[model samples]
Target: MIYLAARAITTVFLLVGAAMADRTGEGGATIGSLSMRWDGQWYWVVATAGYPADLPLDATGHVTQNAWAFMPLYPVVARALSFLLGGQYPIAAIVVSLIAGYVACLALYHLLHARIDRVAALWAVALFAAGPLAALFQMGYAESLFLMWLFLALLALVRRRFGWLYLLIPLMGFTRPGVLAFALLLALYGIVRWRHRASDPLPARQIVHIVALGLLAVVVGFSWQWIAGIVTGDAGAYMKTELSWRRSWIGDDGGFVPFDGFVQASAIWFRVWGLPEPLGYVALALLVVAGAALLLFEPHVRRLGVEVRLWCASYALYLLLVFFPQSSIFRLLLPLAPLYGALALPRHPAWRWSMLGVGLALQWWWIDQMLVLGTTFTQIP
Candidate 1:
């Protein structure tokens, strides 16, 4: 236990130390995020003041609320920290993000310790601490907030904390839409477990608990949509926006989108280099070729084990569903870095570590590029 604690503390310190070391311009000067990147500017404005409905809209004529701009949790935490720190909102924002990033590392340690072996868990936490995702956490954006909540939700899940899961699930939606999948999965799991185990050796109260858990997860999972509807005066409006955003980019009339379906659409997503002509079909064929190579033997990655395969497969699908290319897919996949390590086949521990080495190099490139994060897409400007 002491060893685990010590390892976790050291890993957290490393992540925080690295983050603190990078919180500024050259010459060790502390630079506020106000003029840094796109999301950084949005968050800086939010810290100075709450979002107003009359903020300037983009050329698309969207209502331009900070609601669609940044997630709420980090900004809320930053506001409190700013108030207490003599109104230095920028410092407070950086401090909050670094602290949240550190906490997430600790949570990841525990999350791993619960499932995998202790050594593997420690290694996973260390890898994550120094991973490309770590760079995002160091920025003023809400990636740290999303990751911390995600780790917390996972920790709660591993402990079978159904009630806490219910609470966390709703907050997860408020964090980023990626979490809704987790909530829905949890809800379905509860239902399936209850339905299939009705004749098992559990008491009536246990059955009631299962039913309640399932119902809570379902309600909480969808709660964000309902709230957004009330806020926007239209049920599923936000959902439609999210879907429409994808539809416009990948729908039938979308130039690059092939008729093969979402899979084809996904294949074409990463190849758009702001080309005017439709390159979707061309992109789709290229992806099919690359994907087939990865599956076959070029990368030599194996498709064995459900946990191993699903991690990469599901993540690829998730990316396709979200379809973006501001940063490399490798950097965006940093949040789930631990899972990728889990998915590596042929047991090349050295190769995996080397890959992580590559990831750190990539992270540094992004940090230097200053294209840390945002929903608008990132490319350090």
Candidate 2:
């Protein structure tokens, strides 16, 4: 445990620290103070300055595309932590992002070590710590914190403490509506498991509990939308705004068009974004195929219990909803962090080499462009 903890902290410090400094600034903590690429800068700014609700966006308003506003949970956390940290939101945001990232790694170490071989577990986690997605963990975004919540919930499920999963799943719903699927999936899993073991008399308590959870997902997933609608009264507006965050998935004819349209749009997500051409898409396609393969072939997976399925399923569902086979190849596949240790970690030398090579090359490239230089500020006006 001690060695795992040390390796976990050391890996994050080396990887995330360097990349954050590169993207935010050479000044280490100063990089995330300004918005860089996507949702990060806005989270940090709103945390410190407070939420801005006006149109066309005020200096303080973190702009949205259509319906995709900043999910409130992380920024709200940023705000509270910023207040606690003497009003230094930048430092606060950095602190939260870094701490959450390490905590997630530590949890990964603990969770994976139990399932995978010791050495493979260590390397698997190290793979995640230094993987391409590690860059996102450093930004003032919720991915790391969101991941922590996810792993914790699934870890509880593994222990067969259904109560914990029930509680935690709703919290995930509050953070990202996408997470609501976890609750729904768990209910489906519960239903299927019960039906398969027909003679094993269903546990009344568990059935009621699981159904209650499914209901909760319905509320929490849309509560944010309900609130937003009451305030803005623009049903499609918010949905349109959210599309900007996922244009890679917005589709060719502006929706989930039929076969031809989907093929064209998916082609754009891959070709225009260089997702598949870069080999990343190949990895994602492989993972998706692997998941489909699981549902098709694995019969005992359900009997092995909900923890194994739910944790793995949550990430698989996340990928499917986003559905951009190219960009997601493996770069943003960090949600698989828990699975790093769950499988028999890269046993074959050939497999290990491929995984390591792809992981390292892609990770290095992500960091190279993520950093920001501050020289423009000091130049003569």
**Whole-model lDDT values for every prediction:** 0.54, 0.57
Name the lDDT of candidate 2: 0.57
Candidate 1 TM-score over all chains jointly: 0.67
lDDT of 2 by residue, 1-381 (tens): 432443444344445645666555465443343223345666655555544353243254433443236567777777788888888766666567677777777777666655655777666666676665665555666777777777776666555567786677666765554666566666766767687767755578877766776677667777766666655665444554554444434432363322332234454556656566445445556856888667446643433244556646765675566443433244345565665553325467677657756765665555444433222311100
Best by TM-score: 2
Worst 10 residues of 2 by lDDT: 372-381
What tens digits encode model 1's per-residue C-alpha lDDT throughout 1-381? 422343344344334444554564322323343223456666777666654433344566443334443456677777788889998776777777677777777777776565455656666665676655555555566766777777786677556565575567566556555653453444444554566675634456655654665466556556766666676666644544444334334443332332334454444553455553356666656775776555445332442222223334444555555544434445556556445334333246896678657656654555544442322433432
Indicate which candidate wins on lDDT. Answer: 2
**Candidate 1's error at 348, in angstroms?**
6.9
Q: State every prediction's TM-score relative to the real structure.
A: 0.67, 0.72
What is the clash count for each candidate, in the order shown? 3, 14
